[model samples]
Target: MYGAITAVKDLALTVRQGEFLTILGPSGSGKTTALMLLAGFISPSEGDILIGGRSVAAVPSYRRDQGIVFQSYALFPHLTVRRNLEFPLEMRGIKASERANRVDRILKRVHLKDFGGRMPSQLSGGQQQRVALARALIADPPVLLLDEPLGALDRNLREQMQGEIKSLHKEFGITTVCVTHDQEEALTLSDRIVVMRGGVIEQVDTPEALYDRPATLFAANFLGEANLLEETGSDVQAERSRPFGMVAIIRPERLRISTRGAPRSPDADQRQSVIGMVTDTVYAGAQRKYHVQAGTRMLTVREHVASGQQVYSPGDQVRLEWLRSDVRFVTP
Candidate 1:
């Protein structure tokens, strides 16, 4: 408790073998602290950390044999890419020939084969990121800890690197843990995600399950865009009009927007309908984001850009419908 300020509290988790696990949270959410604790950089106040059925709470960072990729890349300024990759091997006192082979293999694997001789300054941001990842994996550690490894890259580069990281995990089968505030990144790459807030684990589950059925209000809002609606003391189980009592989570993408007097009845009987007025509309290349005011609550809806699709304008009466099973319940 840093002088009575608890940075992390009541955090519990178990990572399976060769799984791509991501700890997703906002700033000061204790995500980084959890990674540090697993890496053996810091010991937890009252909990024991078990790795492969052995406790590693007392082990030092260097002795843990875990690979870590920092947000800043943490490569030596004066060292070339080759030497930087070689640092971990040199620290382990491996044979000179073995270190050379391992460095060459990883450099080639990360697609930085020819950039080894170049200084870190001579490389682009993406190249430097690849080098950092190679350095971390060159040692063949059992566990890999990535702390916002793609935060320094642009949007395009970040997306590209996400694919590469996932590919590497499949090839190496290394049990990986990544900490990031980016929701999309976590959703795209994680086999399972652990959501944190105020130093507590809010929820942990597969991305599909977590997004489709979030058990808590924090998770329902944090993972993506959500329309949280309050229930007015009615049993939602019996009435199709009433949402899941307490609070209902209607995802923007799950909502279907239809202009008044639409020709087609798409799944009419199975869907719950809400009458609202279009408040705003945002056009994008592949789809449109719409804001609808239904009963004093603003709800967002996303629809694909389809040929002959009806576009609703402000002040237009519209109906937003979704399958009865789509409205997930989020308890207070």
Candidate 2:
């Protein structure tokens, strides 16, 4: 709590051993604060943090058996990569021989054995990132914490590093908690995700479950493109599966768009159809997105770009349909 402005309030979470958990949220959502609290950068006004069923709320950051990788890489500019990797071990009082061995093994593990003699300034962004990760793991800490570790890389590099992080996690089987605002990063890396809003946990579930079955409108909209069907409610009022006091939302990918005169599917009776005019069309590399104006709501539809598939223009009329079961109801 900073000057009475509670950054995170009543937060409760448990990360299982060897599980990769991600705390995802936008700016001011308190994800960083939560990570800081767990890292012992700041003490929580209330509630205790437990590691392996043992309370460590009062433990200092350095005393806790945890490794951390920051977004900046945070390598010492003057130190060689090998020296940076060895720093953590030296701090922990590991002998010189053991430190050198551990550094060599870790550098090889990150595929940077030969680059160790170079200073941090000599390495590229990706190389520096690997060095940081290796430095964090050189001491073999029980837990790993990542604070937007890939934020400094470009799109392609970020994607590449995501695979690297996943492979390392699988190999090490360390319980890791990462904080990031990137939806794709969270979706791709997390075994389970905790979505926070306004300092409170909005939802917690597996990546697939969180995206497919969000419990609130904020989560549904935050994770991906959720088309809120304001007028769609009337079309599917007879849907017995829809709960009371909920609004309907469907993913842009779940919705299909066809020409206005196109024939209905064989299971038309089991779907909801709406007529709308295309407001815009986007040609993504592998997929196409269409913005359609239906009733009072503007809906976005995404489909793979396939051969022989008709492309709609801005003025073209289109019909959108989706399976009744695809319509998820979430709290407003």
Q: Give me the runs in candidate 2 sitting further than 4 Å from their true place.
A: 232-234, 237-239
RMSD (CA, Å), each prediction: 2.4, 1.3
Would you list the clashing residue pairs of candidate 2?
none
Candidate 2: Cα lDDT at 43:
93
TM-scores for all candidates: the values are 0.94, 0.97
Residue 298 local lDDT, model 1: 86
Model 2: per-residue lDDT, tens digit, 1-332?
99879999999898999999999999999999999998999998889999888888999998997999999999999999988988888888999999999988999999999998999999999999999999888787889999999999999999999999999999999899999999999999999999999999999999999999999999999999899888742466325567888988899999989999999999898888888999899999999999999988999999999999898999998899988888889999
Q: What range of 10 consecutive residues in model 1 has the weakest lDDT sum?
A: 230-239
Q: lDDT at 119 for candidate 1?
A: 96
Lowest lDDT block of 10, candidate 2: 232-241
The candidate scoring highest on TM-score is 2
